[model samples]
Target chain A: MALTRDGPRSLGEAATGGTLRLAGYLLLGVMLMMFDHRNGWLPRLRGAAAMLVQPAWRLAATPGRLVEDARRQLASAAYLRRENARLRDNLLLANVRIARMQALVRQNRQLKRLLDAVQSLQMQGQLARVMDIDLDPFRRRMVINRGARQGVHVGQPVVDAHGVMGQVTEVLPDTAVVLLVTDPSSALPVVDARSGVRTLAYGAGRGDLLDLPDLPVTADVRVGDELLSSGLGGRFPAGFPVGRITALKPDASGSYLRAVARPLAHLDRSDHVLLLRDLAEPFGPPAPAPAAGPPAALLGPAAAGSAAHPAPALRHGAGA
Target chain B: MMRLDGQRVLFYLSLALAVLLLLLPLPAALRPLRPWWPALVLVYWVLEAPGRVGLATAFLTGLAADLLAGTLLGDQALRLTVVVFLALRFRARLRFFPMTQQALALLLLLANDALLRWLIRVVSGVPLPPPLAWAAPLAGAALWPFVFLLLDALRARLRLREP
Candidate 1:
C-alpha cells in the first residue's frame, strides 16, 4: 500500500482516481433513483436488503414501545376500570347493531336473488398493527407490522374506522409499506354519495385533504357531500367512505372545477388497521353461485382507508 | 494491529449508534428539529480518520440508511457522497477551525445536503417537503459541538487504552 501510494506519481493519480470514483458513484446513484422512481428493476434487491435490515427497524422502535408501555402501566387502576366498563357497554351496543345488520344482509341477499344479480363477495378483514416510525415527510407512507408472511401483498387495501386510507406498495417478510391517500402520487375514485356523481380524488400532499381536479364546472357537487369509493379501477372496493367535500372552485383554466375535501379517517391518530383482501382476484373471480349456497366469502375490489381497525362493522361484514 | 482493530470497532459502533438515533421516532412538532445524525458522524470520521472513511464508505452507509428508512435507494447515498467528498477535499483547512467557525462551515455543508434533498424531491415528482424541513441543518449545526466533544472523548479513551 505504501509503495503504491508513496510513488512519485501518487499526487496526480490520487486526484484522478478520486474524481473518477465520484463520477462513477454519482452515475450509479442517478440510475438507482430512476429505477426506484419508475418502480422498475429494484424491488427484489430492495426487498432482500429490507429483510436483512429488519432488525434495525425493530431496534429503533424499541424505545417508543417502551415509552408507550410505561404510560399504560402508570395509568390509574380506576381509569382502567372505567375504560373497561365503557368498552363493554360499547360492545353491547355494537352487538345489537350487528344483529340488526345480519337481518338486513339476509334481506339484501333475498333481493339479490329476486333481481338475479351476481352474488357479492364477503369481506374478512385481518387486523395489523402500525409501526411507530415516520417515513419520508414529503411522502405520505407508513409501515405496518404485517407483510408477506401474513398474506399481505401489494395493492391490498388498508382502512381505519372513519374512511379510506391507502393500499400496500411493498411487502417484506414481516412488514409492509402503505402509501397513504394524501400522497401526491395517490388517486382514489370517489362518488358523491348524494348526487351519485363520480370523480377521482387526488392526494393534495397534505394530511387532511385531497383534491378533485378537472371536474366539469357544472357538475353536481356541494361543499358538505360525502365521497365514497367508486371501485371502478378494481383496486378499491365500492361504497367505502373516503372524505367530505370542503371547497369547490374554478381551476385556473376556468373550464374545470377544482374541488377540495377533508378526509374522514383520522389521518394523524390511528394504531391498529384492517387490511382488506378482495377474494375476487385471489379466489379466481367471484363464483356465480346461488345466493342460498353459503354466503360468498369475498367481494368486489378493495378500498383502503388510513389507520386503525375502527370500522370492523364495515370491513368484517362477513359472518352475517 | 490490535489498536487498529479497536479503532475499527469504535468507528463501526459510532456509525451504528448514529443510525439508531436517525431512526428514532420524533414527535410531530419536534420532527423538523431532528439533526442530521449519520451525516454528522460521517463528517467526524472523515475529518479525523481520513484513511478509514472515504466516498465509497459514505455511499454504502447511505444506501443502508435508504433501505432501512424505505426511501428512494440512492437519495441518501448521493447526499452522503457529496458531503464526504467536500469534507475530504477541504480537510486540511477544516481540521484546524475553532468550534464556532467549524460549526459555521458545517452549516454550509449541511445546507448543501438540504439543497440536494429538495432537488431530489422535485425531480422525482414528490411534493415539496414542508418548510420546516430546512430547519434540520440548523439543528445539526447546533448539536455539532456536543457531538464533536462526545465522539472526541470516546476516541481519546480508545487511544488511551492502546498498549
Candidate 2:
C-alpha cells in the first residue's frame, strides 16, 4: 500500500498482495469450517456471533411481528369472546382430566409400592415464544426466546399443544436453537398407539411428514395409527403423540415397509412452544407443587405469568 | 479530489441494510427468488472503494452471514472472499463500465459465488441442492441496477466521500 501510494500500481504488483491475502483468508475459513464440523469446537464463538447479530434479526422481524400484533389487537370483541369461551371449555376439560390423572397416579404409586418397583417422576414444561424461523432451505430450525438464562439446557425436549415439535440443540444466553422434527437430521423412537409396534421415525424434510423406514413387511403399523414417543432414548418423554401414519409403501425388495406420517404438532405455524425440563428420574414423582384447584397452579407464579402472557398464536401444552 | 469524511458511516449503513434485507422473511413461494443482498452491497463497495472494503471485510461479513443464516461456519466466508477478490482484481474496468456492462459482470461474479457455495456444500456432505437454488444469482443480478442506484443515491444524500 505504501509503495503504491505514489502512483497506480500494475496488476502484477497488486496481485501479489491480493493473492497472499486471499490465501490467508481462505486458509482461515477452511480451518474454521473444519473445527465447526468436528465436535463443534467454537460454540462460544458462535454464540457471541449470534448475539452480535441478534439485534439485526430482531429489527428485521419487527415489521412482521408488529403486523401480527396489530391484527391481534384489531380482532373484534365477538371473536375475542368466542375464543375466550372456547378456552374456558378447554380449560374445564383439562382440569377434569388432570384430576383423574392425579388419582391414577396415586393408585399407580400404591401399586408400585406393593410390587417393589421404582417410582416415576413427573416432567415439567416451560413456555417459550418462537423468535425466528430458519430460512435456509436445507435445514428446518427455529429460534426460541428461552435459553440458558432461563434454565433451558441443550437436549431438552420441546413440544407444542398438539405434540412433540423438536429438541433444543443449542442454547445461548437468551435463546435456544431447535432442530424441528421435520428436519432431515432428526429422528425419534416412536410406537404405534394401537398395536404397540416400535420403530424409528425420521424427519422427511417436508415440514409435515416423517418416514418410518426399515419396518419389516409384517410390521403392524397401519394408516391412522398414532405414533407416540416410546421413551427409548430417554431424551423425550414417552406417550407424547409424534405423528399419525398417513401412508405406507413396501420396499422394492418387498421385505421392508416404508411408512410416512404427518407430525401431530403444527410444526410450521405454531408461534409458541413448551420446553420440558428436569424430566427427573425415569420413574419418580414430579416435583411437588401446591395442588390448587386448577392445574395452572403447578406452574408457579413465574411460569404461569410467562405462559399466560398472550403471545400471538401461542397455545399452552394440554394439561402437562 | 473526492472528500474522505463521513463515508465510513454510509459504507457501514449500506452493509447493515443488506443484512436486514437478507434476514427479512419472504413468503415461501418467493423465497427461492430472493436476491443475494449482501453480495450486491459488497460488490458495490468493491467497485466504488476497493481500498477500504477488501478481502478482510468480505470475510468478516461472510462470517456474520453464516451465523445469521445458520449455515456451516466458514462456507459463506470463503464464497464472499472469493467474489470480493475477483471483483477487486478487475475493479479498474468494473468501476468504469457502463451500467449494462457492469450488471453483466456482476452477474458472472454472483454466479461464481453461487457455484463456489454449491461446491463447498457438496464437499461438506450436503446433498446437491435443487436446480431452483441456482436462481438466486440471477435474481441478485436483476436487482443489481436498483441496489447500485439506491446506495449511490444514499451515499450522495449523506454526502459520503469516495476513497
Candidate 3:
C-alpha cells in the first residue's frame, strides 16, 4: 500500500497519516514486547531470524580469521620453536600431574567402594569456537559454532581454560548462544574452597566482577578464596573452578554482606570454549564381575559388601 | 513505472555495508562508542528518497537489526519506526539544510531513538542500559555528514534520476 495518497495531500492529512502509522507501530512494538516478556514466544522466530543472519555473521568474522591465519603462517621459525618448547614443557608438567592423578583416582575408587557408592562416568567436553559476541551492553552473551546438530542443548555448562565461562542458553540448528556469567541475569551455585560454604553467585552486569548478594554478615567469606561449582542444580557439573572472592562489604541494611568475585575465565579474549556433556551409563560394574569367576577373590571386602547390597549399588550406578 | 536503476544496486550495497558495520565487533573499551549505523542509513534514505524508504522499510530493517544484535524482537522496530516517521515528517526542511545543520537534526533524532529504545528495554525487563547508550547518539550524528556525502557521491556517480 502506498504510504500516502498519490495526489498532493494537505499537511493535515499527511500529519494524520503519520500519527496513525506511528500509533500502529508503537502498538505493534508494545504487543510484541509484552508477548515476549510474558511468554517467551519469539525464540523459535529468533532462531529462524538467526539463521537468516548467520551468513552475515560469518562474513563479518572472515577478515579477522584471515588476519589470524596470515599471522600464524608468517610466524618466524624461532618464535614457533619457542612456542613449541613451551607447549612441550606444559605437556611434561601435565603428564606429571596425571601421574599423581592416577593414584588419587585409585584412592577415590577405594573410598567409594568402602562407602558402597557407585562409579561415576568420565565427563566429556566438546570444543566450540566463538562466532560472534553480543553487542548489547546489558547482556553478556556470545554465539558459538556448535548447536543442536552437535548435540548441544540448552543449559549445558561452558568453560574455558581458566574457569567456568557460562552456559548455553539458546540453540539453533547450527549455532547456539551462550549467556556469560557476567550478565545481570546469570546465576550459578558456588562453594568456597576453603570452607565449603555454598552460596549463589550472580553476575553484576559489570565486567570482571560477580555479585554474591546473599552472604550473611557473619559469613566467613574472605577475599581471594576460590569458588567452585557446587552442582546443586544439576545444570553445571560439580567441582569446576568458577571464580575467586575479590571484595566484600556489608550491605547498607547491615543484615547481609555484599560480595564480588573475579571469574577465572578469560571472558573477553578466549576464542574457544568447552561444552560439558554427560556420558551414557556404562554396564553396572560388569554385573558384579561374574560372581563365580576366579577374579571374584580380588573383589575385596568392600566389593563383597557392595555385592551383598547389589540393589543399592546398581540403582546408584544406573542413576549416574 | 520505476525501472531497475544502477542506483538501486548502490543503495542496497551501502545498506549492506552499514549492516556489516553494525555487526562488526569493537574493542571492549570502544564498544559503547559504536554509532547506530542502520539508523543512520535509514534516516539518509528517508530524507533523500522518501518514496523508497518508508515506514515498512524501517520496520523490516529494525527487525533485521534486532536479530543481528540479539535484542528482544521489535525493540529496534519501535525505535526505527519513530526515526523514520520523524524524518519523513520533516524531510522537506531537513533536505534543504546544510550538511552540518542536518547533522544537528540527526543528533536529536538519534538521541530520541536511543532514549525510546532504552525506555522500552527497561520496561520490558532488560537491565537498565548504561550511560553509554546516550553516547551512541553523538557518534551517530557525527558520522552523518560523512555518510551523507558518500551516499550523495554514489548516487551522482550512478547518474540515476531522482523521482
Candidate 4:
C-alpha cells in the first residue's frame, strides 16, 4: 500500500525531499572542501580510509596477481635460459670491473676520510620504496612507503641510482611525499660540469624538461654538457648529476639564452630512493686570511688603512 | 508499483556491480580507458529511481569514488552533483528516447562532466592534457547500450518490473 496507493503523495514529498537533498549535498561538499584545503584533517582521514580499503585493494589485486604468476610460469623455462646466459656474460665482465673498482674504492674511502676531517661531516641516510605516484599527474611527486616512523623527515634529499630525484616534502605516519625536481615549484643550483659555471635550474612544469634562465649569451654551455648539483644552496648534496643540457637557443630578446636539460633520474620509473638526512652547509670555509700582515714598509699604510677598514677584520673574525 | 520498486533495487545493485568492475585491477595501458563507472551507474540509477537516488546519493557515491581514486576530496562529489541534477531534470524525456538517442544524450552528459573536471583541475593549478582527455566520454557513450542491456538482463533475472 505504501508503494502503490500513495504514489501521487509520495511524488509530491519526493520533490520537496529532492530539494532538501540537493541543499544538503552542497553544504556537505563545501564542508569537505574546506576541511581538505585548510586543516590537516584529510590526510589522517584519507590514511584511515586507505587502511579500511586495504583489504579491498588486496582482493581486487589478487586476480591480476594470479594472472601474472601464470604468465610467468608459462614463460619460465625459456626466460630462465636467456636470463642465465645474459647473467653469465655480465658476471664475467663485472668480475674484472669489480677487482679494479675495489682498489679504487679503498683509495677513495681513505681520501674521503681525510677530506671529511677537513670538510663537513657526513650523516646517515635511509632507503625508501616509492609506494604510489601522485594522483595529480600535473605535479611531479611520489609517495614513498617510508614515513616519520622510518626516520623520513621533510626536506630530506631523495636520490636514486641515476641522480637527485627530489626531496621529501610531506611526511605521514607510514608514507612520505617527494616533490621531484621536475615539479614546477622546484629549483636547484647546478654547475656546468665542464666549465664549473654555476646557474639555477628551474623545473619547466613539463615533466621532461628543466629550464635554465638568465644565462648570458656568452655563457659557456652547450648541448650534452652535464650539470651537477653545486650544493651551493645547501638543499642538495654536491656532485650528484642533475641533468644534461639537451637544447640551447637564443631568446628572441637576445639578452640571454634559453637552455633546457633532461634530468638524469628516470622520474616515472624509479621505485626506490635514498633520503639523505644531513643538511649541507651554505658557505664553505671563509676566504683564507691574508697570508701574513702587509709587508713592513707597507705595514704603516696598511695599519692606517686597517683602522679605517675595521669592517674587513670584523668580517674576517666573524668568518673564523 | 511493487514491481517498479523492485526494479529500483535492481538498479542500485547493478550500480554496486559496476563499482566492483571499476575497481578491478586493469592493465596500466587500459587504466585510462576505464570509463567513469560510477558516473554511468549513477546515470542509470537516477533515470530509474529518481526518488531513491538523487543528488545526495550522487554526491555520496562520488565521495566514495574520490577516495578510491585518491583524487582531491570533493572533486568527484561536485562533478556528480552537477551530473545527477542534469539527469534528474531530464529523466522524463530521457526515458522516452530510443537507445541510440539515449546514448547520445549520455555522451553529452559525460562530456559536460569531463569539462567540469578539467576546469576544476585547471583552477586548482593542475595542468591537464588537451581536449584529448575527453576520450573517456566517447568510450563511455559507446558502452552505454551494452551497459543498459546488461542491467536489463539482471533486472529480468531478478524479476523486477518498471512502473
- RMSD of candidates 1 onward, in order: 10.3, 12.3, 8.9, 9.3
Name the candidate, 1 or 3, with the larger TM-score value.
3
Interface RMSD of each: 4.2, 4.3, 4.3, 5.0
When only the first chain is scored, the TM-scores of the models are 0.78, 0.78, 0.80, 0.65
User: Quick one: best DockQ, which candidate?
Assistant: 1
Higher-ranked by lDDT: 1 or 4: 1
* Native contacts recovered, each model: 0.55, 0.48, 0.45, 0.26
lDDT of 1 by residue, B1-163 (tens): 5544566788898888887787787776776667878899999987777777878988988887877776787988989998888887777778899999989989999999999999998898768877888988999999999999998888778777764
- Docking band of candidate 2: acceptable
Over 4 Å off in model 2, which ranges?
A: A1-16, A48-57, A99-103, A119-121, A133-137, A280-320, B1-4, B96-101, B126-131, B160-163
Which stretch of 10 consecutive residues in model 4 chain A shows the poorest summed lDDT?
A1-10
For model 1, the stretches where C-alpha displacement exceeds 4 angstroms are A1-17, A279-320, B1-4
> By lDDT, highest first, what's the ranking?
1, 3, 2, 4
Q: Candidate 1 at residue B153, lDDT?
A: 89
* Model 3 lDDT per residue over A1-320, tens place: 22232224444655778899889988897788788778776677777676676677787777767777898999999999999999999999999999999999899889989999774636899999997444465678888889899999998889998899999988887888899998889999899999898899998875657999999888888999999988776777778899999899998899999889999999988989999898323332334433332232455565765576565555555655
**Global lDDT scores for all candidate models:** 0.81, 0.79, 0.80, 0.72
lDDT of 4 by residue, A1-320 (tens): 22343123244554566667777777787677667766755556666776654444444445655776687788868798998999999999889988998898677778979887444535567887765323444456666777778888878899887888888876666677788898777899999999998899988866457989868999999999999999886778788899999999998899999899999987767756888887656545566755443343445665765464455645655655
Per-residue lDDT of model 1, residues A1-320, tens digit only: 32222223333444667788998899999999898889654456767777576678778878878888898999999999999999999999999999999999899989989999764757779899878776765677878899899999999999998888899998889988898898888999889999999899999985458999978998999999999988777788888899999999999999999999988877667778889986322212554532232222333233233323424534445647
lDDT per residue as tens, model 2, A176-218: 8898887878999898999999989888865347989989998
In Å, candidate 2's interface RMSD is: 4.3
Chain A TM-score of candidate 1 vs. true chain A? 0.78
